[model samples]
Target: MKAADDSYVRVAVLVMLSLSLLAGICATLIHWLGPVHRPMDLIVPPVGSAIFGGLIVALWRRPWWLQGIVRLALVTAVLALVAPAWFYTLQAVSTPGVQLIVVLPPVSSLFVVLLVMVMIFIPGRLAFVLALLCWLLIALPVLAYLLLHPREAWTPRGIDLLMAYGPVSLIVVVLLPVQRGMAGTIRRLASERARMEVMLHRDPLTGIHNRRLGERVLRGVFDGARSAGVIMLDVDRFKAINDTHGHPIGDRVLQAVAERCKALLRADECISRWGGEEFLVIVPDIDAAGLHLVAERLQMAIARLPVAPVRQVTASFGATMIDGADSFDSVLQRVDRALYAAKEQGGNRVVLMPVRPAAAGALASG
Candidate 1:
């Protein structure tokens, strides 16, 4: 099913643009084998999309440029399909009674594009059932026209639109149900797999990436970037909060801080819950000094949020960037040590680890 009516209109435009080019060319080749080329054929080719294209333009109110292109392409397709019949209509041999032959028109090509539209844009049983109804609707008209006017419908230089084209459309629509069912099953499976993957990575209590997954993600980021900030964060006096507010309230506080940190993590950030009351984060572009800025930002985000029934909550953060070509593992170890130092000094304060003598001096000042 279409997500909305606007989406249906866009899909219709794309379908017309894609299938018309291919089907129009095919129709041109097939009808050339017929006889009796005519002025009408040169003028109109084989008007398939014209009817439906016009319908979309009127119903959807598609953009003027798209409508213009649709009108032009549909006209071109009709002209291409009918081009072969230009001469024969004028050269009809007179009969004692009138030498007559049987033929169908060139409505087959239109049916082909319409079938593709149903397959691509529409979903489920509706696509198949509606397509079947349309097939019969278009098929009968071509069939009747071919039956009534055999000489015109099927000539050596002409089209046998109904008799030749009708059955092909009916068969296509009949096949749609199976194809639609298969596609639905595949999409559902893929969506479910993705949902499960997300569940596996998450900590159920805190809704944060679990330690293993978070570590994996941060390691990848640190390895990929030339410079990055590794920050360790812990909820301030989390034990005291748990003791005073109860474990349920403590869980809520942890959940709130996790959400704040997650929001702070941009496209190049990876953050996860390292353990109870602790979180780990990696920011790809930050240097040692820039790491301090990032640490401060996380501190603010944690402190700013309004968690219901918990008036005052804050997080202490410690950050360090790799000093001169250190391995990702060493960088993490250094940063995590710095985090412990911050907790020892005072709760709710940001601490920075010195990667070099200059950084050490800056940390003392901080």
Candidate 2:
């Protein structure tokens, strides 16, 4: 489950447990204050209190058992509230001089609280179904009893209770499904946003960060005032491979080359498909020696494999340490020049841009 869903469960469990404690306390006060001796009423409060308290403790200690705990709490809360309302409605009807309208209306109001609780704690489809069942179990029985007793219908109180209990319950039942639909829409939108982010940043063919994301990372390295390096590599005679084999096999060659480079690089280093048949590698906290070593390793890894149908593959590399004063275009221009120099030297070799540390430092401070 997601962290948000886990948090929702925790909060729901806490709310139910707190309400159970409140109910238990109120029942205890009523039992002491009232003149009537109701043994069942007295028994319910402590039992409910124990169940809720134990559940709270169990959840606090072992939150991994949340699914089971939520299911248990939902069922327990429904039974605890529904049973009392049913028994209270029956008791109010049997006794003399008890106004059925006044008694049943208050008992029926409890369903409203139950409906809201289920909507908040449970997920959409299940919550609506549970709320509907509770309404049927509690509201239907009370409405039936009032309808059967003819004397109860003669009074204005009976009509008031009937309206509040019957039609009101039906209204909430209709609205809950609409709420569920809205929640489902929100979840789908969140999923779409995540998918769009991946598409924007990642290469579809190689499944690595693309040029746009690589440039953004490069800008961060420049801003941090740290020593870093960029290695620009182009597959030597790449067009020849595409000409010899089809584009499909050429694509496989690119994928194979990308996998080889990725396996050799450290966690902190990044390789991006710079453009057609060209790749750019970014390495942070590196000196000139380390940068050249990485470029050589990449060259060896790609040349080692057949890459199917193609007997051998080689890459020409151009590397330079990032200067503090360089902008994005300036850096690319310098690396491209070095790459041209390597290709001019007959390909499959590493060329490093000449460095002037003193001049670079002066420019950086200015």
Candidate 3:
């Protein structure tokens, strides 16, 4: 999650830097083409563009000082607007009969951009704190000047700038914490939902899929008319092991068996704890030969598994392939019968059951 957040921040920073560079180029172009050109426009835009370009390159390289660099860039952007507003305001004060509305820079709209950047890039209380500081630095002077010139403050442009810098900025800062709280709530709920889903589908003892999930997967296979191999496995003499070494040792044995079996299966395959000392495996897209081979491998793996304080551990496997016309119950019944046959045959062996003739007819008809 931290890596994802860092990635988001990097992308946002790059976008912001690119926009700043573009803004500088546009400002320079406007000054160059306009009938009246100012020395400050030529000097500031080119210099600021150079700074923005350098920051863009630095962000692309991604050094250890990237966080400090972002902070610096944000500060520079804010100052670019704030300095102009202050300068024009000071100039207006000195000149008599100067129409403040026409002469004053429209820096209030740009301040909104800086405020949004602060809110997005900065975290926790610091963001609001920075916002307050920004309001003070940018709005305070204009507000004081307006208060002094009451007639100008009541004008359309004056009122617009006043509301923008004052109430509008305040509302944005005040509502942000509430927005952050709601976002945090959403994240927590999503995380909790994922955890509950895991608990629902997973067996508590073996940390494998539960019977419910296994049945669901089997049902999906049947619904899709796909071929799959089902292996019903039972730990041989599980009750005897529990009686001799206690339930704790038996649990450990089950866990080890589950781990080993899971390791052997493909990512598309699933193994579930079907019941006590029993597991159900679903391997998709397998033929009868491949299914039998898989069952043999699982049997050998269990036979070779060494659980401490036990001489040896083994499991019996009953393997069968899906018939196209088989229902969930019918397939499970076939696997269960095969498992019973394996138990009867001295256990710890793979038993394969062929598809029923009626089911094969159903398949052929379909």
Candidate 4:
């Protein structure tokens, strides 16, 4: 797991680095053009944005430090980009003879505003604010110099380009990552919901469907679906095992019994721990006669299951088919009575529910 996680982190970082490099190229071109020229390098924004998007997906499951490292690397990339541009501007200042290329009047800072909006949505508040503060701290001296001296640095054309592109750079930084964060958060929430559903429906100890789920599945099967049967199983002498060998071993025995039952069941069947030492089995594709064969096989399967030193770790099974006269409750009551009959007749036997007619049908027919 760690190796896979590390690989994902490396891939995410690589993607982010590649995007940053592309952004650097676009920034260089933007600076290369000056005086009210438009940003023809529109392709760079999306490439950079996608790289950041990939990084967010990769880092979503990574350790906190890896996420921080990615962010820090982006900040460094920004500095590397802006620093060289300053040098380029300085050279332009000394050479009065050089003619400057011009683009749409600088709207860099305006771009940063849009980025901030994105950041607020994606990276969450803490990360977005921390990043903004870091950028502000780094730019404090430069911002102060620009404010205190407002005197233009370098060629008239160069300063105008900075005025236009600076905000765009900031906006791009904030917006790109923020959008990715929003997507990651949504994905995370969906995953959590799926996991919660699984937990609610399954038994943690036995790794089988729980009682609540078993009933729901059985109802669906009987309501409009296939012919079905209910198999109520009780581990014969299970209470004796708990009394003599202690609860811990008894718990293990229960777990063992559950696994054995699961092994015997078809994929479409469902099993649940009905209560202490008892279980409920729902077979989806069987009728009353078909279920009798299942009960015999299940009884044999229980005999085969091991319970440590105990020589006879067997279970009693009582099954019933849902006929026209029975509701779900009536079926359950009949099955319970059948199970009691098996125990009373001597343990480890399969007992089937007795058929009976409904009074309403008799009275109406009469």
Candidate 5:
């Protein structure tokens, strides 16, 4: 998340620098072509344009110096804006009548832009403090001058500038924190919802999908009319193991078996803790041979692993392929019966059940 935020900041910096460079160029062009031209416009615009262009090149060459460059750019922008506003206001105060052609309108709007940048680039309370200082530095002088000269304050231009630097700027500064708070809330809620969803579908002990999720997946496969392999795995003599080594050891054994089985399966396959001492494995797009192979692999995996206190831990697996005619209950029953057959034949074996004729017909028809 921090890296993502840094990336966003870097992109923002590049865009702002490009825009500043463009604005400078346009301002210089306007001064050169317009009827009313000040010497300061030619000097300041060209110098500012050159500085922004240099900053852009520096940023492109040394991207890692983003933080320092951003700070410098912001400081320069604030000075560029505030200095003009102050000069124009001071000039107006000294003159006999209202200087209707002052730079207050654009400068006031740019202060708002600066405040927005401050909010985005700076973190925590510091951003708010910086915005307040920026507002005071620029707005105070203009506001004081307007109040003292009521005639100028009453004019349309005066009112527009007054609103821009007064209520408009203050509103932006005040509401930004509220907007940030709302965004933070949305992110936190989304994170929490994802966590809750994981908790709902995952078994706490083995950290595998719970029966609920397994059932949902099975239902989806059946509804989609897709062929799949279902394997029911039962830990051999789980009760005896619990009785001999206590439940904790039994739990560890279960966890180890789950891990081993999961490692053996493909990404498309799912293994879930169906209930106590039993797990359900779902392998999509598999035939009887493939299904039997998967079951054997799981059986071998469980038989080979030794869970500490016990020299060996084993499980019996009953495997079957889905048939078109098979209902959820029918499939589960067949897999359960196959698992029982494996256990009866003496646990730690794989038993594969073939599709029944009626189910085969249903499958063919489907």
Candidate 6:
């Protein structure tokens, strides 16, 4: 189900459980305080309240069990509403005086509650239909009893029942379409926003974070860390591969390189396709030795296997550890110089750059 639909169902569950609990408490109180009354009046409310309260607790603690709990609620609600109406209709037939016919049965309130529950939990046209059917089933038997015995309709109880059942049911039914429309709109908007975000921050070809997202992540890493590692890598002889084969094969090689590097890095590390054939990596809370180990692992992982269609491929890596004093531009310049040195002498090697004052820093090959 869509998130909006699931949210509506949860809201419905909470509302039904809460109202059922309150109704149960009131019914139990009425039985205990009021006259002896009907046998069911005493029995049903306390049991119903206890069950509702238990279900609420289960839902709060284990939301994963929602499907089972909702099924139980539906069955319980049907019985709670239908059983009472059936019992009261039988009582009206045999009993005497205003007790059965006065003030429209309390069952009407229960009917409305059931209708609200179905409307919110079940979505679309089906929910509305179920609400209407439930109302008919619960109300039909009592309506028939009043019709068969004309004297019963003349009483105040019959008029109150008509008033509660007529206008209230109509209003609740009307609201279903409105709720469905609003939920659908919200789901559509959420989906679109997610699609736009992916397009904006993700690389079209490699399915890894693009340069834009990498920069944003780098800023976050820089803010939080005292020392961090920044590695710049370039595929050796990348242009020759493109010329020898084709751009499609070249693209596949890039994707393979990304997959290999991603597998070897920790979760907190940020890796992105810095540009065509060049990638940037940021590892926070890492020292010079840790950064060198990471760079060596990446160098071996890429050079060990010939990514299909290219008989052999190797990458040159330049890594440096940054402290509180370094600026982003300064770090990039240092790593770039290391990358240039690696490519100049040999391709399959790792170079470590020392970070010191601009004049003091020196490059060392690893």
In order of appearance, the predictions have TM-scores of 0.69, 0.72, 0.73, 0.52, 0.68, 0.82
Candidate 2 structure, TM-score to reference = 0.72
Best model per TM-score: 6
Could you give candidate 3's per-residue lDDT for residues 69-184 as a string of tens digits?
78988888877877767776777798898756776545677688888788877888899889888888888888888989988899999998889888888887877777878988
lDDT of 2 by residue, 117-236 (tens): 677667757877887788777677667878887678657767766776677767766776677678779888988988898799988887777999889888888779778999888998
Give a tens-digit lDDT track for model 6, residues 262-322: 9999898989989999999998887888899899999989987567779998999988877
Candidate 4: residue 176 Cα off by (Å): 4.1
Sorted on lDDT, best first, the list reads 3, 5, 6, 2, 1, 4
Q: Count the backbone clashes (under 3 Å) in each candidate.
A: 32, 0, 0, 18, 0, 0
Top-down TM-score ranking: 6, 3, 2, 1, 5, 4
**Superposition error at 257 for model 3 (Å):** 1.8
201-265 in candidate 1: lDDT tens per residue? 99998787898887787666645646777888888878888888799999889888888888777
lDDT of 5 at 352: 81
The model with the greater lDDT, 1 or 3, is: 3
Prediction RMSDs, each to the true structure: 6.6, 5.6, 5.9, 10.1, 6.4, 3.6
| lDDT pick, better of 4 and 5 | 5
> Where does candidate 3 stray beyond 4 Å?
1-80, 105-107, 222-227, 285-288, 354-366
lDDT of 5 by residue, 134-184 (tens): 888878888888888787788887888889888888788788889989988
Candidate with more favorable, higher TM-score: 4 or 6: 6
lDDT, candidates in the order shown: 0.64, 0.76, 0.84, 0.63, 0.83, 0.80
* Candidate 4 error regions (>4 Å): 1-173, 354-366
Distance from true location, Cα of 110 in model 1, Å: 5.6
